[model samples]
Target: MGQSEATVGRWSEATIWLHWLGALLILSALMVGWSAEHLAARDDQPLLFEIHFSIGLLALAVMLARIACRFFQARPDRSQVPPLARFAASTVHLLLYLATFGVLLSGLINFLFLGPVRVFGFVTVPQLFDPEADEWLRALSWYAHVYGWWALTALVLLHAAAAFFHHFVRRDRTLRDFLPGRR
Candidate 1:
């Protein structure tokens, strides 16, 4: 199927699997981060931070590959949606991608400068930037990461809502567009 028609066609199995896997990983990272923040106040913040940071790195790697695949694949055109709806959908997706990367980068930077980074008990990532580059940057990055989380959460909710609306309300192929071969 061609690009536009592909949207109405059954989604690739690869796409469906990767989409769900990425969703799980991203959600796990968010949950761990939120838990870490709450638990930090009571006990060892270091341990919680380590778990959160590690998960963030994993989520980052997964998202990078996911984004690459998305671009490589022919996505559905938003022109069919209402003008305002299309704009919102595009904006939400853009924000989700940006925030995913931002959170990953910021956390990695923090680990490199302020601490060490251990990824899934596998490899050790070296720090790219010197800690003394700018004190303000670290603070700014931390804030950005925090805000990015909130933004991602909102976008995810909206995305899910829209997909459901198409499935139940519009009675269209919107949900099917992202589902695996004919159910």
Candidate 2:
């Protein structure tokens, strides 16, 4: 379909682009974080760290935009899905967005507590808080960051599974709305 025409219950071009790009960054950050220790030991570790940090920040920014767009734009008609399913979908989406923001903030705080770290080059991203931050804050933020990863993974899996369920089990357009092309 052409840009001029809107697909029913589907996302706009800008929203779709932001969603996919945010997804990519989130996935990349997770991969980097998983290998952080091993990667940090290397000479290029700082470089890798900066890349991960930058992407995480980018994802955070994109998510903020996503939330704003979600509220401002009209969603595709929910009349197609059962009322319960629609409610579930809305709830899941809200949780996903909140969880995503939490993960990003945890990382940011972790870095801030670590002290001023270079983003990717000699240029440094300023710490949001002073180094040697409170012990409790440090420990809590650390756990939050660690657990955030696991939570994010589980949430994404559930979201993906539900989308597939709608596509296969429900035989609905729920999942297709996010697809690049309308069938």
- The best candidate by lDDT is 2
Predictions in order: lDDT: 0.72, 0.77
The digit string of per-residue lDDT tens for model 1 on 1-111 reads 222333523445666767777788888888878887875565766666667777776777777777666666656555556899788777887877887787778776667
TM-score of each: 0.78, 0.85
For model 1, give the 10-residue run with minimal summed lDDT. 1-10
Candidate 1: lDDT of 97?
80
Off by over 4 Å in 2: 1-8, 38-44, 181-183
Query: How well is each residue in 65-96 modelled by candidate 2, as lDDT tens digits?
Result: 87666666655655666799779888888888
